[model samples]
Target: MVTAAFPYRLYLVIAAEACAGRDLLAVAEAAVRGGVDLVQLREKQVDEPTFLARAERLAERLSCYSVPLLINDNLRVARRVGAAGLHVGNHDLPPTQVRAQWPGVGLLGYSLEYTAQLHTPEAEAADYLGISPVFRTPTKTDTVTEWGLAGVRAIRAATPKPLVAIGNIHAGNAGPVLQAGADCLAVVSAICQAPDPERAAAVLRNQIDLYC
Candidate 1:
């Protein structure tokens, strides 16, 4: 059975482009050192071999700390590399399909941006929900739905499932996201593209803690 792996409030979504020429392992290590609990590798552009290699490296990096490494949009790679979980967007494989096909791979997360999409049977098949575009975020150009704080609050009240608020989230605005009932906050550029990913993560972690 799928279970929740998102116990930590500060979620880091890291992509190679966001690393700014730094090694992905280095970036992940720094972020973890600064208190990032869960990580999702969003490297959808690479070939299969490269993707598996990176996922393996990241999984090895986080093993000692016990931080789960989630592979984005590639359940095959996730299982091959022994990734802790999988995260899929709205356009990708629906959560129900993933669950039915895999049986018990790991924790499955689906993107939920609209209140209309809340608490659906597909959502129930997964372990957690990602409430994306919580604000206007350029970090993800493909995102069409921009769910503001009001939407986050609405989804929080509407769904019994665990909520992960993501998109353009930073240290300054994390409080309100948490106040709106987000169980965790997923950040991309806020921490991944910062000058010091470790320091950025620390500040963001403090912001999340302050809200609690």
Candidate 2:
């Protein structure tokens, strides 16, 4: 039987600039209180030490709730801080190599930027596939093709791995995103930029639960 890696329904991707102009730790804590399943720290503008420091602090808080912390493109930091997992894009590190390098990092997530990757050995070994750019968004400048709802449906039909639909996902259209067959809905600006992080998280979680 295949084991699920990303078992959470609400995936929150937070960046320092995106956290409602507030402390990311505070925003994440409130988001957890509102029911975030997992959290990924995707800082685009920070040095190694700064990133490591932030990860350590966030790991401490998220651990209390038993929520997994995933580092974006940084396996060293994740392991250094005793993070639960790491999220890697296709361009970062090959999943096969990562698996060989760190066999113990339990939750391995692979970003699916194109349809051709669905059947690769990497996808087969991955615990979850992040279907990104489900809609056009400003959060990521290096985005792949806009997956749209149709793309989600196509990828869902093509893969057995747990799907984490990302990019521009919000409470407004979260139901459809889930219905399109994503096991989890990952958002950046939606909750991170909300006026009230807890409420934003709650609303998104509600949508996920409702659709399920």
- Identify the candidate with maximal TM-score: 2
Q: What are the clash counts of all predictions, listed in order?
A: 0, 0
Summarize candidate 2's per-residue lDDT along 186-211 as a digit string, tens digits.
88888888899999999998888887
Model 2: ten consecutive residues of lowest lDDT? 1-10
Q: For candidate 2, what's the RMSD?
A: 1.9
Which 10-residue window of candidate 1 scores lowest in summed lDDT?
1-10
Q: Whole-model Cα lDDT per candidate?
A: 0.84, 0.86
| Candidate 2 Cα misplacement greater than 4 A, ranges | 1-5
How high is the lDDT of residue 155 in model 1?
83
Model 1, TM vs. native: 0.94
Q: Tens-digit lDDT track for model 1 on 7-58? A: 6788899878888888888888899999899999988788988888888888
